[model samples]
Target: MRIHVKLYATLRRYQPDLPRGAALLLAVPPGTTVNQVLQQLAIPDNVPLVTMVNSSVCRLDCVLAEGDTLNLFPPVAGG
Candidate 1:
């Protein structure tokens, strides 16, 4: 299966070489969960994340489907 992933804010460091706003095209096995992809990307478990699948909020355990778009964002803090 294949998916498109976009990293935002601090999470963008995970894939720095990609052009801004460009999706990281990934080839994953069928039934792969969001958590597995995070692990593969070496994103530390301690880092908080806001996950979205195809533009809707999703949990880390969400099962991904072919052509799904997964966007990852780190929580924002403001004064």
Candidate 2:
């Protein structure tokens, strides 16, 4: 399946080779979960994942489907 991923905030640094704010097209096998995608992208396991699928918030265990658009943002903090 093919999915579009958008990395935001500090998470953008994870893929420095990719154009900032650009949607990345990834080809993943069937039954892939959000967590799996992040792992494949080299995102740290402990990093907080704020994810949205097609504009709705979803869990990391959410299964991905073809044409799914995923927007992922790492947890942000400020005082």
Candidate 3:
């Protein structure tokens, strides 16, 4: 299966070669979960991240599907 990944804010550093806001098309096996994708991308487990699947907030255990869009964002802080 294949899916699109978009990294926002500091999470973009995980894929430095990709242009900001570009969707990284990734080919993954069936039953791949958000946590697995995070590991595959070398994102640290301690990094506080917000995950979204197809625009809906989801947990790391969420299973991915072909053509699903996964958006990763770093923690947002404001005054």
Which candidate leads in lDDT? 3
Per-model CA lDDT versus the true structure: 0.95, 0.91, 0.96
The candidate with the higher TM-score, 2 or 3, is 3
Q: Highest TM-score: which candidate?
A: 3
Q: lDDT score, residue 8, model 3?
A: 95
Least accurate 10 contiguous residues by lDDT in model 1: 70-79
- Give the per-residue lDDT digits (tens) of candidate 3, residues 1-79: 9999999989999999998779999999999999999999999999999999999999999999999999999877888
What 10-residue stretch in candidate 2 is worst by lDDT?
A: 70-79
Please list the Cα RMSD from the true structure of every candidate, rounded to 1 decimal place.
0.8, 1.2, 0.6
What TM-score, over all chains together, does every model reach?
Answer: 0.95, 0.90, 0.97
Candidate 1, residue 62: Cα displacement in angstroms equals: 0.3
Candidate 2's residue-wise lDDT over 39-70, tens digit each? 99999888887999999999989999999999
* Candidate 3: Cα lDDT at 35: 98
Candidate 3 segments whose C-alpha is farther than 4 A from its true place: none
Please report, as a residue range, the 10-residue window in candidate 3 with the lowest summed lDDT.
70-79
> Mind sharing the TM-score for model 2?
0.90
- lDDT ranking from best candidate downward: 3, 1, 2
In model 1, which regions exceed 4 Å deviation? none
